[model samples]
Target chain A: MQWETVIGLEVHVQLATQSKIFSGSANKFGAEPNTQANVVDLALPGTLPVVNTEALTLAIKFGLAIGAEICTHSVFDRKNYFYPDSPKGYQTTQMDYPIVGPGELEIELANGTKKSIRIHHAHLEEDAGKSLHEAFHGSTGIDLNRAGTPLIEIVSEPDMSGPAEAVAFAKKLHSLVTNIGITDGEMSQGSMRFDVNISIRPVGETTLGTRTETKNLNSFKFMEDAINQEVERQIEVLESGGTIAQETRLYNGDTGLSRPMRSKEEANDYRYFPCPDLLPIIIDKSTIEAIRATLPELPEAKKARFIADYQLSEYDADALSSETKLASYFETCAKTSDDAKLSANWVMGDVSGLLNKNDMHISACPISAENLGALITRIKDGSISGKIAKQVFESMWAGEGDADTIIDAKGLKQNSDEAALESMIDEVIANNPKQVENYRAAEADKRKKMTGFFVGQIMKASKGQANPGLVNKLLAKKLNG
Target chain B: MHSKQLFFTSIGLVKPFELVLEQTMSVTKDDIAKVAKLARIQIDAEQVPEITHGINEILSLVDKMQQADTTHVKPLANPHDATQRLRADEVTAINERDKLMANAPESDSGLFLVPKVIE
Candidate 1:
């Protein structure tokens, strides 16, 4: 029986606030275990929490960016659960009234088709701390540095069908959040986490099937892999006379396997109640409009502008404008080089390749955008060949000086001088007499292909500095003459 | 609901009344045991009936209070009727780990050590 996979994603984005959501404690990563945890974060007796204004502002900013209805009044609720990471024994979160109401995110699939994923809602919550099991003897070590960190959990409707759609939605959401400067978007540092709910039913079945949630997947690749793995497992179970269990599962990316979290399955009841310690957050209309004004150029808007202003292809504009930093980088490079298409190609191809090879983000790229633009500018002019510009780019990436300096020092300039290229073509034509004779006798198409031999010889003689375009024009003129 | 109406009236908002109270709400010994377990509170089996009876009485009082119609009243998240005050995003908390860890039963390497929790 054919089965269709139904999936939804719950994305938890840690807001980039200077302090914790409800306390003045530092919300920094990689801090000493409990150094950043304050009395409020530790949930000490006689202590109370004060909401951070910046956290609320950031959440509102995100809501505005997504065209979601900003909840004028939202309340915090306590999700009762017993865990070492939660010092309060109850996670302070938004239950019924979330901050952001229904919104839609349009994602571009690989087939160049657009699909809108409906976001159910986004809520503000405080993050739990870390539980380190290793490096302790028969005990778990609890670090409260991350406790009280502000997070906006964006819940999506079960609109996605398969892994690709899920991944595309995740990537699009990541780009959107990062571009709006809400989260650092460092998936490695757990700034953003994903909980994917997957279920399967017969292809034509209208009713929903029991779903299993794979929790805490940090990376897109893992989300995709986990979705595929869970979907396959559910199908196998249903096909072999077994029912799919509705439980939370953990996906170990290392082993490429998922297993049910037995502890979580037994304790599924998170009795939530409105928190009495804090009052409802009431946002005014002026404040919402102010935050909306501060909303940066979102990815979609930037992509449209890139297409309209820079005249970039839809694909190129989408790739370049996906991230704010990359879009600005491409813009600077294109403007400096006076060629948008070339800059787009170089940024998307060679520069991205280098960044991926070194496992570095575009922000940490060693080559400055202006420097790359200078190199491309040299190629645009007759100063250097595209091939030599690549060599120069490597040198620039290696901390060498600018394009002009590298070309002058290495003597890698393109010999585009008409007299020089003509003489080199003449030398190649004289040396390859038989080939030249055959070229003169051959048909137009075959003779056009024979120019490569002379061009190669002349480039070799000129030490690869001879201009290929000029050499081709002069070679055809001299050979055919 | 009576207490809620009183609280709202005290805050200068009068709630309209249409009395409809459900007296079926009651607690059982098993429910008491479950609540006790959930709260991680120890309760002897002999005391379950007494606790359940006590809870049922309180619930009866609550049911009587529920007679007050509060359909027009907004759900009161806090009794004070005050919105949350926002603080500036500044880190004023110092590294009080050494001072705070003094209260812990066991701590090592700046981490609070608890009984092994394997998941």
Candidate 2:
């Protein structure tokens, strides 16, 4: 029986701020434990949470970006819970009224399918401290530095059906948050965290099945795998005449299965009530629109614009617009050389491959945009063959300046001279008499592929400097008749 | 499953004692105990009776929330709705070791002191 896996995600993005949400303490990441803890962070007697104006503004920026309904008046709720990670016994969060409500984000599946994940609401809350185990001696240590940090948790509607869509949604959220300069969206640093709600239903059943929420799966791949594994587990249980119990499960990365942790509970489990300390936040239309004005062009709009403006392939445009830095770099290069397709092709194909292989970001790329544009222009002008241009790019990777200097230093100029390439083409033809006879006798379609082999030989004999177009013309003449 | 009349119904049709004895519709004690364990809070068996009662009360509240046609209602995650105000990207302060460590239970030589960290 086919089972549809229903999935939704709750992502918490640590807002990029300099101070703790309610306190004046510096919101630095790597400070000593408890050192960054101010009186308010410690929740000392008489310490009150003064709402950070900057944090509120950041939340508004997100609301506008996603086209969410910005609530003019929202109240903070105290969610009472006990955990070592939570410095305060209760977390100050939004329960009754959230700041941003009902928006949609578009995610592209792994199979190149695109879907929109409907957002329920996004609200600002304080992050709990980190419970560091095995970081010190045998005992666990608490880092209050992260405590009271401002975070915006974006919750999604249960609109996704599989892990691929869930991953796409997460990635889309990551790009949106980072592009808006709201959060770093670093999954590795626990900067962005995900809680996945998963359930399995029969192929055509409309009524929702019981859902188990798996919390804190940081990596995108693991989150996707965990959802798939949990869906399979739920299906097996249902098929065996058992019903899914609404529960919280733990995803063991080692075993690649979710073990039942405990049954899930209603929100009142924490006895959620309005927080008394902070007052209701009232935002005006002008305030929200003002923040909207500052928002960078979002990923979807940017992707569409890149396609039309740069005349880039959808794949190339999508890949380039995955991050702001790469999109900016590609745009800068295109502006310099007016070669959008070339810029998109190079950034997506070569530059991205290099960065991923080295585990680096585009901002840290060794090659600058201007230099890359110069390299593309060289390839365009036939100053170098595409193969030799790759060699110059590798030299630039080693800290060499632009294309011309690298090409000059390495003698990578294309052998565009017709006589020189024609002689090499003759040598290729002389060496392969039998293949040439077959190529001359074969059908038109068959001869087309064989021409490539002759071109390869001529390009190789010329030490990768043979201009490909000239080499192809000469090889075709030498092969036919 | 038999739908037992709940004790705390809007209409007083059933007795509270009969409601506790009836195990047809509501969640069982075993499930509540399991949920408490999953929540990582230690609840004594003697407290199970009270915890189960509390859970039932909360579940009923959730049922009420679910009754509200929330298909159109957006689930809220944050309370403050506006762009987060940002500061100019710059670092302005450094840690003052003595001042920071002043609140430590024990300290010496600008570092917080704890009993025998390692042998």
Candidate 3:
């Protein structure tokens, strides 16, 4: 029997607030272990937490972006648990009444199909600190710098079909959050983290199967891997006459396996109660409008605009506008050159290909988009062939110089002069008389194939600087005669 | 289930029924054990019954305060407005890890080290 994988994601985005959610401690990454924790973060006696205005406004901005209902009155509850990372006995979060209510996100799958994933709710919460396991001589070390950091947990319904759809949903979320300037969307630093709940049931079954939550999957590749592994594990267990258990599993990327945490401490019963210290925040409709007005063009909006404004294909627009930086880079290059299609091809083809090979991002690329745009202009103007343009682009990428400077230094300017190209064509014909006779006697389609020989010879004679269009034109004239 | 708890504002204003419900509430041995476990505290097994009795006695004494009807009293969340003391969200923290970690029972590599946690 076929099996279907059901998946839902709980994403935590660490808000871009300057201070802790309820404390004045610096909300930053890579700080000394406990340095950023202040009295309020440390849960000192008589130290009460005051909500940060930036955190509140950013949460509102996210809610507005999703077109979700912003709860006018929301309370902070205490999620009681015991762990070294959480110095306080309880974590302050929203339970039952979140700041953001029902919403939806439209995710585009790999096959170019769009599916809407339902969002249950999202709430503002404080992040716990880190627990380091390797350095303490069998003891675990805790870094409280991340303690009390502000975060917004977005919960989604189990509407995903498989791992690919789950990843698409996550990528869409990452783009939306970063596009709105709410968070930096850095996966490596745990800025945007995902917890995927995965389960598999027999096909055509309406009831759901027990799921195991794979926690703290930061990278996209890892998230995809974890879901696939968990789905297989559940299916295997079901097929072998075993029942799946509902538990939390950790995906070990090194081993390519998922395993349940130690069972002794598997107790997850959190006694939630309203925190009495702080009052609930009441957000007005005007406040939501004000935040909505501040939102930048989201990913979908920018993609549509790129398609309409530049007359680009849907796929090209989608790929270019997925990330804000890449979209801006494409825009800069597109506007600088006359051939927008050529600019798009160069940016998406050679530029992205080189960056991926070297494991660098577009923002860190050595070649500027302006320089690439100018190089495309040369190719359009017949100053350089596409093949020779690559050579110039490679040199420019290596920090040699701009497009014109590199072309001049290497003498890569294509010889578009008809006289120069005709002489080279004549030289190629004189050297290959046998092949020329063979081509004249052959069928009409046969001589078409034979043109490559003369074109190759002429290109080599010109040291690859001969204009390709000119060479092709000269070759057809001499070969047919 | 009274969701008056959901509203941090507009609370205590509805009626005196919620206050009565809270006043009549009492804890059993199981409730005490569960609450103590959540708070990460340990108590002797022999003291469970004594603690239970003590809590009931204390709760009964506090129940006397609920007898007075103060229907004229207006409900308020705080003395001031709903918004509390305002401070601009800025980073003013200095690195005090060394001083802060001084209180830990054990530390290593600028980290607070404890018994190996299972999860």
Candidate 4:
């Protein structure tokens, strides 16, 4: 019997606020451990946790973006837990009442299947400090610079079946958070983290099987691999007549397996109670509406607009909209050039390929959007063929010159004039009389392909600058006659 | 259930609820020690009982969160919308080698310090 893996992910996003959640300490990363920390972070005597309004506003902004209900009154709770990283004996978080209610996220799978992942709720909490084991003499050192940093833990329903959906969901979430200007969503720096809850059951099993919660999945590859391994582990356990234990586990990338860490705990174990130090957050209707007004065009909406406005294929639009930087660059190029489709093709194809090859980003591209637009415009205006424009683009990419200057300096203008193009077309026909005869005797379908070959030769002879439409018309006329 | 103390007395159970060993979720004192070790914290051995009790209590709280009819509940993934509040996408900050080394536990002129390597 086949088994289906059900997955849910709880992602922790560290807010990009300048200060800590409760203290005035800088929320910056990579600082001296205790230097940026304050008395509150050290959990000194008589220091109380003062909730940051900016952090709370950031949480509400997230709620509005996902169409979740913003709770006017929400309370912070004390999660009693002991750990070296949590300087405060108890972590201050939202338990009984979170600031935001249920939300939803819709992600498109690789196969173009759209799946809606339901968000249970998002709550604001303080992050724990980092433990640097590489430091200290035979002991791990604790850095409280990240301690008390505000984070919003977004929980999702167990709606995903496989790794692809899980990854798509993660990328969608990462893009959404970064796009909203909330967090940098840098997985490498641990700014964003994912903990996926995975469970596998027989194809038609009604009751949910034992689930394994994988922690510290910092990258998309890890997220996908972790889920696949855990699912396989559970399936093996059930197949061998051994019961799978519901527990927290760690993923070992090298071994491609998950090892149990501990039993998963329920929330009540934290002794959660409303934090008395901080007051309940009350957001009025106007606040939510004002936040909604500031939201920019989301990726889904932008992708659709690219398809409609630029007359681009869905694949091209999706690729262009994957990164905010790339989408902006495309828009910038489009603003100056009327050939939006051509611009999309270049940006998504050649520009993207070059950037990937060099391990660069669109923002790091040496070619400015105006220069790229000039290259496309040159092609459209018969100054260069599509092929020569690519060469000009390569020159522009190397910071040599703009399209117009490069074309002039290299004498690469298209031979699109009636006389000039006809001369090249006739030369090709004269050199290959057999091909010309075949072009005459071939069926309509074969004739169409020959037209492409003849056009290619004319453009090649003219150094990729023969007017393609005129070359096609002249070649057909010459071959037919 | 309203007269909870009286009802529990009638059922031969008392206030604070007499937790049966067989049914009390069974987190042993040794398990608590192991959990603290996994969490990488140093706690006095004598404090294990109290810590175990506290962790059990907290775990019960997490249990309550899971029990709440969250069948249709969606988890909030991030607190912000899907837009990057991008800065000028330009490098503005520079790493100060001197100041960065100043705070190091041990350092040399402008480099971080390490223990002697060669004989």
Candidate by candidate, in order, the iRMS in Å equals 5.6, 9.7, 4.7, 13.2
For model 4, the superposed segments whose C-alpha errors exceed 4 Å read A29-35, A109-113, A135-137, A262-269, A417-463, A466-481, B1-119
Tens-place lDDT per residue, model 2, A132-199, is 45445544555567888899899999999888888888888888888888887777888899999998
Q: Relative to the unseen true structure, what is the C-alpha lDDT of residue A16 in candidate 1, on a scale of 0 to 100?
A: 99
- By descending TM-score, how would the candidates be arranged? 1, 3, 2, 4
Instruction: Please give, for residues A343-410, the per-residue lDDT of candidate 4 as tens digits.
Output: 88888789989999999878899998888887888787777878788888888888878889899998
Q: For candidate 2 chain A, which ten residues in a row score worst on lDDT?
A: A262-271
- Report the number of the highest-DockQ candidate: 1
Candidate 4 docking category?
A: incorrect
List model 3 lDDT by residue over A1-481, tens digit each. 7999999999999999899999889998887778898777877789888888888788888888888889877777777678888888789998766889889999988786789999999999999999887766779988889999999999999999998999999999999998888888888899999999988888899999888899988889999998877887888899999999899988876777778976555557675666667776677788778888998898999989988998999989989999888888888888888667888898899999999999888899898878888998898898999899999999999999999999999999999899889988888889889999998999997777888888888889999998888788878988885
Ten contiguous residues minimizing lDDT sum, candidate 1 chain A: A263-272
TM-score of chain A of 1: 0.96
Candidate 3 CAPRI-style tier: acceptable
Against the reference, the lDDT scores of all candidates come to: 0.87, 0.76, 0.83, 0.74
Residues A203-322 of candidate 1 have per-residue lDDT tens digits of 999999999999999988999889988888998999999998789999998888899998644566666667778898999999999888898899999999999998999889999999
Best by lDDT: 1
Error of 3 at A245 (Å): 3.1
